[model samples]
Target: MLAPSEVSPRSLHAVSPMSSPPSELTPRALVAGGLIGSVLAVTNVYMGLKTGFWESGCVLSSLLAFGGLSALARRGAPLSPLETNLSQTTAVSVGAMPASAGLLGAVPALTFLGTQPPGWAVALWGVGLGTLGVLFAFSLRRRLLEEEALPFPTGAATAELISTLHSTGSAYAARARGLWVSGLASVVLTWLRDARGLVPAASLLPSTVRVGGIGADGLLLGIGWNPMLLGIGVLVGPQAGLSILLGSLVAWVGLAPGLVRGGLVQGADFASLSSWLLWPGVGLMAGAAATSLVSQVRALPAALGDLRRLGEHGEGWESTAGQWASRAVFAAILLTLGMAWFAFHLSPLYFLLALVLAFPLCAVCARATGQSDIAPISPVGQLSQGGFGMVAPGQPGLNVAAAAVVSGAASHTSASLWSLQSGRLLGASASRQLFVQLSGLLLGAAVAVPTYFLLVSVHGLGSQALPVPTGLQFKAVAELTSHGLNGMPPSSTLATGLAFTLGVLLSVGARGKLARWLPSAAAMGIGFVVPAYYAVTLCLGALVAVVVGRLRPSATQTVQSAGAGLIVGESLLGVLIAALLALGFLQPPG
Candidate 1:
């Protein structure tokens, strides 16, 4: 049924036809990517822990790399498009370490379960799992990216941005200036609020609102003075942002009071409410993600065909898996299984089962991300947990660890494919990008592993400051699997079931034109887990973007750059604040 046009080799180079290979994989590009990735590694750990959302560093990294490299190029060698892609790819790889390392979810869930994994164990586990995912990307690049012609919107956007930046001399400088100006402004605002105590945590809101006998503070309703959330709102657009807002209002304003009156929630604080709300939230996310994955079943055979023909093409490492690529993949499997055996004490059976399941799950993740820009990372982990719960039974630790491996691999697979999508458009060497991405993985683990521990030590997991909502979902799933709803409130169980059904229905309805008008179940689920203020700010950010676009369409990208700067600026500042608190230079907020 496949068309000859789809399988033609020339289609691979349709975007960029070069007479000679460009200057890619340079030491400067690698170093630039490594350094930027180190910062992103730290930034993402802070952002992921606090908000349960991590930004892709590609666009921001592209601008930064271009700005820096272009500056130096004026006096020396010129920068090439492929070289910039390599740098951005490397930076994204490093920045994505927090998720791949399980710091955002599973590993933190372990700590909550009273098992603190050593830094070395966590690092090794991340590298092994991430390497497996990267190998999957390597194997499927030609098929998914070249043959299938998946949109990969993020990659296309990045590629377009790169071409635009390089085409005009001043374009990069202008965007870079906007990025840094907004970033520096965010840094200043964060310092004023967090460090110097000059700004209130929530700027524009009433202190409290009383519903019946329950008094709700603006902060409790999730209104806060955080630019990062607003920035996220801008990036995600109106549909998701508004969905989150609706979810927040429904969860906090509508549900919290009823729970308080029912004596289900003992207090109006975030911790008290989220403990009960997370059940329904987690259920909704699970249902929607499950539905989404099932929708991709039709593509499995094609994905498998690609997997089967991974090394058959004789186009070297770019289009085919040559001897070196095959050896590396085998090595990656060994490293992953070895880490599973040594670090988590997972038996070969469980590890291999997870490995087998990961291919389909990661394939679904990649395709889903390409089609809809949603990676389903959390859903992938929960699915793993459910599988292991049945197989292992009564071993919550094993369930959590197994889920961690699957999610970690999925995360890396998604990230790798995104980079490869851009590379294909730029005619960059897939082999070289793979090498750079792998290097970023190592560098990120090295820098971010320590930073994760430091932030946890200072902020404390499950605290109001670092709620680690994603981790709580993982923890909730593991516990539920072990105990089977023993001691759960009857009301909470009813709510969870209803929410799950609703999520499934919404997901089923979110196809084609209806998708734009429908509420995003995943965003609603996230809104239920995180504080309400994040939703409010995210909506506001989206509003700003919408208004700006209508006023001047040309300024849309500038707004996005500014929003990205806001996120990066505040995230890096949060990390710095954590370090200061750890070193006793700054006191914890009273």
Candidate 2:
């Protein structure tokens, strides 16, 4: 954690163009950063849709964007201090937004209406959702960013990457070479799988290997080998990763297999196994939300105050005559919300109800979670969808989808605020940070929409699609509404809820055995919900982290930095490959 007073105004002063700053960022650097960020954002979102870890996309995107920006900034270029910081920060933040597109579009689209709405409707929802996120986060800028001193782990890694690049300028060349090489390899591999229908040659275990007299299938092995996801597992730590893996195993290997053997689930492929994994994953997310809010309640007021101050500052910048312009923006936001309803062909009254519901939900959730900055805006879009869903059960999908977008916007806003505050604490300018963040958001959103549609088209929708390994998809969840909530067995719900509750208790209370092992609970819960293969890979990551932690106890920061780099690098490469394949510019080898 860092404090506002610890950040000096002098630190925000732009570095002299003559003297090479710690990181000499330039236009070229910005371009490179943007490209990398875009790739990471796209891939992460793609994977998130396949898997159920929506947050992973944003986290990985930020990391990769920062890494690329830092690497480029290390090389000497004609850039002032503010330019360097703003460019790097903005580039990374932009990547975070695209990963959120599904939430911004698909969730709301499906939730407010019965089917997928038009692109314009989705876009308006995205804009309003995004704007609200920024506004809400702005309110808490002071408390979370300035007073709490919570270490912006991702931001710090970015800063360190920049420093490392500056110290060894040649390192940028090495990283670039690595990125291109890995990217080409991934692209080629993916193309071969898609076009030629070629089977991957590599195998972690023999295809014929049997477990408990059951012959292992190629699909099982293929599902198990998600390198990009494994890399993320390493970053999330052994405990959380292992938990997710275990959950997957229970669903895919234990439950799905057992059900099939017993003649209960009849499908040859058991595609519905993915749905089983989703139940717990969703529960975990809900639990996390509830628990986080409860824990952070004390900080709510301060966070809200900071946001209010920021709004005041923005208003004060203009003369009284021009103050009306600010009001016009707010009015515009309202009109846009109305337009979204019209575009979706929904009743205006229903739309108004959604807005009314959003106000309190956002505020209350934020206050509960101690993330007042994001809470203020997140609930509006989601609650609106929920309200609409209740009123129009025929269109539950659209309503739920809308809710997910609201969640993403809120999450993104919080992340941005955190990043900005980190920069401020380290002596960066507030205005510059804001500019960079806005730039990143716009660029990310522009790229995300097409990328999302492309993935759905290429991979297929629902359970038929190739999973993105570590990503989550709200639209897919929304689709589940067609089956009804009763689709989830009561026993399964109870079991998952109990497990999650016990985990939280262990984390917050109990001591000895439970406490010592508490760190692993999140992973286990996640594993219980994900595929067996993913859970296995996550476990591998935990193993690696544990080993590293033991080997260099004094280098925790270093280990974390390196781990962050691997996660971001691999994830970014995956997204870029997907994008290139979609564009027909790069073909995977058949």
Candidate 3:
């Protein structure tokens, strides 16, 4: 890693504007960005709905947009470095737009509510919430990116890639080619497992392997080909990867078998196992993340002070261009409140409470995202649900949906900042980048809202085939808060408490002396909710990353880069496959 430069605090830009000649944010750049962002929005939505997590689009979008735009430039296009920045900024912003309200966390929870609003309402919510996220984040650009110099890793990476592309385009071709190969391989692997149906899955196993009443399939012990899971594991690094594996063992070997043998759980199917197990996983993760987030509250005063000072000085917050930005933030939020109250028939009082909680939560999400690329959005969503479960009791729809208002904002705000960071590094126009970001969000919503319904039609929400894990967690929290432990078995409740405590201890310990050895509490907790097969694949990927890092540290970046390619390729292919399935052009193997 390059050492931190002792850049002056007044240097708001990551790269000097005079470092190289600035290029136009051309019409071609805007269109390419919108198109790329739309495609990535579809891909990430598809991937996230399936896995309950998503890779950041900035790096992938930067690489792809630069290459594609550069190729066009060689022929007839007039793309410039700043234009590539504009394109990437737009792509990352809009591509993840739907995630603010529709894809990952909130809309899917509506499936569990069993009474969803019409599609158009949801589409509008995506746009409004997404825009609010950008507005909310724009105000903090100076505080977080400029004054704090927080390492938005993915943002930095994307910026570095853009800088590389602009300085010398030929050097990028090798990395791009490697990315393509991994992506193609990932698509083929997914096809073989799911569509081509090459892999044989058997429930029965020999006596030695089958312990208690749990069979091999019951434990989900067999490996399944999912390149995306593996790639994600590699990106997360070894500690997190190993933690995931450890969590998988805790579930499949101990929890799954024990539940079956003790007659606590009724079935061995994926849905049956995951539904019961999700509670503890959700709790563990939420509890740990909540503790960590609350601790950051201590630093808020200093950060806020810095922000105020910047505004006072006119060098940071107060600006000729972004001065009226705060007004826009208020307007967008007010519009969001109105939309929530009228369109969805949400209680104005209850929705307002959610809105009040959103700003701080959004800040925390940004802090977490800046520090580590992992945004603990699911846990934060649960935190919102738990808070409001009592505030708006027994109203599952309001509970999940209202929380979405904040979690969505928090999540997308950090996402937009990631894009802005890239823009900063490339010396792109901040105001114009903001404009493209908002525009990309609109484009993402247009594409993503429709894709969501298509996926729902093909796989059906809440099904094992396309389990929206984040939504399920939200649904579970809503139910748990409203019902308490009345519906659950005593053992289940006890187990959940134990897991939660374990999560607390682990996280707190990590914060203290045990920081180095222990795995990420969040990753470990996630293993409890997802299918064991996913954990296995993730572990495999992590294992590969670890081995390579140990044996050949220099090539680790190359491998990780390739892994990223695999993620993008598989996601795009997955979207295509899902589309074909929805259209009845491709029959999923019966």
Candidate 4:
């Protein structure tokens, strides 16, 4: 029996007070929750295509899904932490997956399949990759959750949103209204700017905007003033986001123009520059992962010890339902993997190699990121599929790519489970959370797959066709495949390296005085790898965050909610407009 002090409801204002946890969600509530989850998922996916990790958008989506669910649950039945976790997990998964669309993995799948892979293939891949990710993440959750107390800043934000909405009904209503209004307005402006290609008056601002520079067809490249993104820049603060912006300006505005003027680079030069950005991004991710793993090594023994204790407790952590669900998802994934292999006629040995490599890689990466719960099994999926470009050479098809997808999905599943386990520790019911999570996974996968196809068919992939501003995606791939680090102009690389070293020193040295600048290491590292434009954008976001935080002394939760609302609203609207353009419901302005 849990102690009353441990589990009883305290004051309503208490962050995690146990007032029946928020009531079990009603059927109506579930449907609404799912729909909201779907929207959030879609929006985040779209944003993810722009920013690696989908960042604040997905975080916000999770918050909204949880907050809305909690609010509705008050009227009917209260939801357990398990249920809430499941819903949030599913929604997050949906958004994350779609972001991977049209990348190397999805591209091969589409090119080879000539259409979307069968439902079974997608399901199998999804389940396999998700599960593997979760398992890998499980190994590290104790370390990340307990020892480090890594502020899952986003998760904390979600919890606070739920608490606030529940405690003050009037405030909740007002915020919701504001969100909708802002969202709608953003949607309209995005559609006009992106789909219709309207030349806004802001474009005429000589200092703030530039119009008609050279682009693909010798047509003038039109640039418009983006106050929203600029506002986001302000919120992200001057440090990180501004750094990214400076990098972007240097690459796109400074270097690109210089090259063009000198006749040293041309249309094709853009591709080469993109390659430069990508490798740095890859290196940064790898380094970050490596660093995280090294930091958490001490906690490994304790985590493993917990597993031993769990075993001694006669599988106390295991629920029959959870086991069954896990098995079912696993079986489904296996069957799909088999079918995909059969369809592609892949070498069984290669397929097995890819499948086997996924788990260890995911586990290692997960441990490193302190996200041991989401062990990143899918990155292996990316690796395997990308490797297939070499393994199969000429045969770029669904068979190889689907294998990677399976690996990715398994990783994702493991991550979700880790998240669920965290909820359990915090006093959530297991069964309810598991069920909601499973439901969410299914729903997210179903919606996201179609959305991926829709987006790619309409917008075309990569920076040239899509509005996703250039970043590490193209840059890293280019560096790995085309130019090695040696390709970086010696002076540029030295400058970046020096800056990076200084960033590290500053971060390490200014522990108390400039704590907020720590994330700038990531920015510097990312800046080194990607174009100056993307670095600038990130810096912009960081700046925006800092300014807003200072200006509004309100709780962090309220500010994050507003920021999240802006991100989701703008991103979703962009997608809808993209879809309309693809369907010929709208046309680009001449």
Q: TM-scores for all candidates? A: 0.93, 0.74, 0.91, 0.71
Cand. 2 TM to true fold: 0.74
Judged by TM-score, which candidate is best? 1
The reply for model 4, stretches above 4 Å from the true place, is: 1-26, 55-63, 66-86, 99-124, 134-153, 170-178, 199-239, 257-264, 268-317, 325-333, 339-348, 364-422, 464-541
Better structure of 1 and 3 per lDDT? 1
- Expressed as tens digits, the lDDT of each residue in 309-404 for candidate 4 is 321211435445434544564564465457446544545566566555544444444443333223443344445545555555444453345345
Clashing pairs in 1: 222-532, 222-533, 223-533
List per-prediction Cα lDDT, in the order shown: 0.80, 0.49, 0.73, 0.47
Residue range 1-590, candidate 3, lDDT tens digits? 21114333223234466675546578778888888888778777877887776766777777778888877788775666678778888888778766786577677777777766667777677777777778767777777787778878777777767667667756476667768888889878767766766743222344357745666765667555677777887877778878877887887777887777677788877677776787777767766866776666765665455345432325542475466665576666766777677666677787778877776677777777777666766656777888888877777788888888887777678888888777666566678887887877778778888878887887788675577777777777788887777776537787778877887888888877778897776777777777677777778888898898799876765677677877777777777778887778888876
Name the weakest run of 10 consecutive residues (lDDT summed) in model 4: 1-10
**Model 1 regions lying over 4 Å from their true place:** 1-21, 203-208, 317-321
Residue 17 accuracy (lDDT) in model 1: 52
Q: What's the C-alpha lDDT at position 379 in model 2? A: 25
Candidate 1: tens digits of C-alpha lDDT, residues 148-211? 7777778777777777787886777667766788899999989988888887776434455575
Candidate 3: regions farther than 4 A off: 2-21, 76-79, 168-171, 199-208, 302-320, 371-374
- Cα lDDT of candidate 1 equals 0.80
Model 2's alpha-carbon lDDT is 0.49
Q: Lowest-lDDT window of 10 residues in candidate 1?
A: 1-10
